[model samples]
Target: MLRVMNERAVFGEIFRLGKVSRPELAQATGLSKPTISMALADLERARLVRPIGLRTGNAGRAALLYEIRPEAGWVLAVDVGREFVRLALADLVGDIAARGDERRKGGETPAELVARLGELTRELADEAGAALEDITLTVFGTPGIHDKETGSLQLAPNLPGWERPGAIELLAGVVPDTPYIVENDVDLAAVGEGAYGLGQGVDHFALVWIGTGIGMGVVIDGKLYRGAQGAAGEISYLPVGEGDPLVNRGRGMLESVASADGVVAQAARLGLEGLTSAKDVFDAARRQDPIACQVVAAESDHIAHALAGVIAVLDPELVVLGGGIGVQAGDLLIGPVTGRLRDLVALRVPMIKASTLGTEAVLLGAMAVGLTTARDLVFERAVAQAPPG
Candidate 1:
């Protein structure tokens, strides 16, 4: 029951050369002129492809070339973190039309957060000259493990009381009938980077985020490699130190040394006052403050040590540094981490780079998920509306 000829004409031409003319599609797909014409017409009508321009270099007649349409429908992406929530409205080509952020106050309930998201989404849609209903789908990236079977946040350390019944269901209820997806923030960021940013064209890579907490996302062969329990890259629990009370108790080893809060707390213990946040420490380091510089250097070294283990195990081609703290001090961390890694590994060294997307990576990734979902939905509709075989 497959429309083999039609699908071949469309996908074969698109994937082979990224763009194609009708005659070229016909030639490559081995379809008759009439069949190619009919298929292209249907695809254009569905807004899957659009005329780019007329091609030159022909003696007799010029051929009109076509490209994939990136704005058939909009995608909404949300990145929910412990301190703030960032939202973006993007087209199919991954262009953000409108963006905004809101600070998260302590003790905010899930229903309250969902209502705020609805309000902000409505505002953003209006700013982008788009309607809420026009958005094909929505994806949310939060610091939590989502249970797909029940649509619940199984384990979210940052958001207290966020796993109650109907959390995702209630959020979906706000925008009636709109498709919604929920995923871990780090995983979404990795996907975003791989699809549209630094990880583009690279197959195997690791994205490590150093912020309120330390976490990672692994990509293998161009796809997110979530382990069997959907917690593959949760590296915060890796044991590094032994017999130390602070290192062995509560949060895991990597988080105690590499996270922003961990750095700040360590700085305080070292008699450094007025360093209330990671940004303060970074600024102090920029100002040539010795204590702040030492703190950041120590944290970077710890992260590098942890990454050495990851490299020994996964052998990724690239390691991407991200998150608020990571992006802010990428220059400082990259050199030290790379140096420490060299000491630990003897073989080929992986390219260590900073994330180009910054804090927006997770949001953009969520949008990618939404756009892909919309595309799949459209394909399903086309299949259902096809003529009986």
Candidate 2:
């Protein structure tokens, strides 16, 4: 048991330092030379870590450097959104081996969608020169709350068959051992920001997605906070916005007034002609159309009211505006939203910023989430390969 623990520690060090020498591992892990040697031998035998090169130019004999084998584990990240389904396969070292992005044709059943996903996964695996079973873990970044007990996705009205009882189960069978996860797309976006975007190093923050749908993903103390029922940041249900909250009870209050559809509805109600989408409204606002500007203001007010509620409850250190409308018109919305947010809140205002990653946020976040699980699973498998331990 001690030997296995030592091997894991050494493997962790090598994983962290990229490539490390035995003596360096010894110093880093505070283990003696023989212990480092044993750990390296175990890891090498398991094909988890290997000597990449030599640490030369030293005072004494050169030391061999080791690194985690990049092919030892694989992660498949899927972004199942309203319009697109994206798949990416990455190796242990975070190199994307292959990727597929396709616009989802409207009206496919859950089973058909799962079949399409399977076909894509197999194609990408072949493209990457990896077998179908090589995927160690799969993470699906999708909208709505996934119920573990029932294995059903809740509140995902955008994807028709996704909320069905057996829909998400099919995703797990894409890889070996049925190792997979279905996480809220917005929550995964928060993870992506922490890994590669604006929320990096932020201990507490929220990724507010205002687009075709409205939602928020909260990260507290560097961990995604899925509330008791795993619906922590369903800010769309917020009741603080204008108009009757029950008017769009099916879609929630804030979502009804602040989502893309809401923006378009506001444009029409405010007398803006022929703007079918929020994108058009924002473009018209940029072109200085008076009614469109008023629509933007109305949208901003609705969003501000919703955000004020979020701030009062969560008190995140920062808020990152994301999704289609949030990213495209974020610059426009940020100023007005911030101004309104300032007036609406009594506490110190959190910094508001636009997502740097744009559409890739959820996909990247799924990778991050998968990597977290893959790391542990891979490490345990490697440790298990040690002789007599």
User: TM-score, each model?
Assistant: 0.89, 0.95
Q: List the candidate 1 regions with Cα displacement exceeding 4 Å.
A: 4-19, 27-32, 47-53, 56-58, 67-71, 241-250, 385-389
Superposition TM-score, candidate 2 onto the true structure: 0.95
Candidate number achieving the greatest lDDT relative to the actual structure: 2
lDDT of 2 by residue, 89-202 (tens): 999888999989999996887878888888999999999999987889999988899988877889988777777676678776566465888889999999999999999999
Local lDDT at 66 for model 2: 88
Candidate 2: lDDT of 340?
92
Count of backbone clashes, every candidate in sequence: 0, 0
Collision pairs in model 2? none
Clashing pairs for predicted structure model 1, backbone only: none
Q: Which ten residues in a row have the lowest lDDT in candidate 1?
A: 241-250
